[model samples]
Target: LTVGPPPTPIPNPQVVATDFLEVNREELQRWVRGEPGAFDWSPFIQHVCKIEGRGEPWQEKERRLRGRLRRILPIDVHCADPLGAPLRPPADALLSTFCLEAVSPDRAAFGRALLNVGSMLRPGGHALLLGALGESFYLAGAARLPVVPLDEDDVRGALSDAGFTIRDFRSYAMPPALRTAVDDVQGVFFVHAQKPLEG
Candidate 1:
């Protein structure tokens, strides 16, 4: 998606509702405030630019991202409890990264969470998920937090069970240098699944 500027209001422009959920709201707030060294998103933006063949400078991209963040207020923060407190008005698409695997203790919980998240989307809506694969635990500061080691099959099965059709999926093995840096994750996966249209 092109991250230039928010589109101007047109006569009946398509409305795409969105919401933010985080296990730790404070961390998200810190990142929004542009705190020093808070969640570096440059690498991700650069990667996308490379793939899309967009040669925009880093400064411009950062400016656009900051502008978008400025629109977020405290009221926008929502609890990460997928099965409990869900956002209103539902969403057309949901993007989650590195959160489900970190919080889900096992495969069952992961499936449950997937279903819960799917519930937040309207029929025919899409969900994009990215998470570490085959990772039992990851280091958080000085303590080790648990992660459910999941493979591609596990993810595909869970998504299917959660009433989603897998549209796109990919995986990448962790590099040797990065593998030993923090977590013992074997690989990472990116999945794009769509809910079935209403009959």
Candidate 2:
């Protein structure tokens, strides 16, 4: 929860896996660099304002960024509840990404979500995923959520259904304090995939 200077050795994949979410900022920046016309950062910019407790500036900036991104990229950026309701990816979207913190390890649900990712993204878009490593316990607010450990084969199957080729997939271990000998392996899955870019 505390954001400090990055640790040496990068703290392995588990300790710093949460850092993946923060990478969104860099991804957005990169998108803008490549296609400023398609860049829309209103959503994230608004979130930043909320963090700073500044409303007016946040609104103005959000509006402007949304306009800019919409102009350049034919993409729809939204804050969606994937579990509450089903959502589909854009057929024309060249790149799509998702980050799920609380997801049931149910195979059916996972399969559906992965299929949705493949269905929405056009050929040659990336999907980056971060899941709680191993079966671990964590408190959300006050309630504890137990993570169900996922192996590489399980992850690969889901990606295959989504018509994606796994470019990279790995398991990460959390800090020793979070680790447990048996159930609390404190591992997560990071997978990067891309749909075939058909010529």
Candidate 3:
């Protein structure tokens, strides 16, 4: 999902939501329409409320989120314009998870991909990125999908070179007990980085 860009210090703006997925998008629509057999987001809402610590009822939060979401679009990170049409004024923030590494063949490609995705986020806006660390491949059913093996330094340098200022960078090491032969992921990383404000 994305938030509209502004004249800086935009404390509030009309909240609209967008996500990438044709099938998932349809499923989300079904839920919004209160259709039976639609996937329920109750668990996720409850977890979010718990983490928010606001004691807000999950139903309220769910209703609020569902109401805000009006559009869902497919994303092609490699496209010069991810959404086909460039969003005017751009978006104030973008959230990406396990996307970069999956699409990139190597660190250089990863950097380029990040630059492409960052194009959507306006200056001074933040991008929250989550991805596996040092993972070369993963399984998609019987198919073994290949991915770029990334480390902390790679992500840090890419963000810097892409003109993003690192606000926070954290990594979680993979536990041996959970490590499987299907993938060689050593850990995972999360970064909150901001684009520089225009001069």
Best by TM-score: 3
lDDT order, best first, reads 3, 1, 2
TM-score of predicted structure 2: 0.47
Q: Indicate the worst ten consecutive residues by lDDT in candidate 3.
A: 10-19
Model 1 lDDT per residue over 106-191, tens place: 89888887887777788888899999899998887999899989999999999999889988899999888777857889999999
Can you tell me which runs of candidate 1 are displaced by over 4 Å?
1-24, 30-40, 67-85, 175-177
Q: To one decimal, what is the Cα RMSD in angstroms of model 2 from the true structure?
A: 13.9
Compared with the true structure, all predictions reach lDDT values of 0.74, 0.52, 0.84
Evaluate model 1: give its lDDT: 0.74
Model 1: how far residue 5 lies from native, Å: 23
The TM-scores, one per candidate, come to: 0.72, 0.47, 0.86
Can you give the lDDT of residue 193 in candidate 2?
Answer: 76
User: What is candidate 3's CA lDDT for residue 81?
Assistant: 84
Q: Is candidate 1 or candidate 2 better by TM-score?
A: 1
lDDT of 3: 0.84
lDDT of 3 by residue, 1-199 (tens): 3355654555434343445568876887898887899998899989999999999999998887777666666777777787787877788888888888998888998998888888888888889999999899999789999999998999999998899999889999999999998889999999999998999
Model 2 shows how many backbone clashes? 9
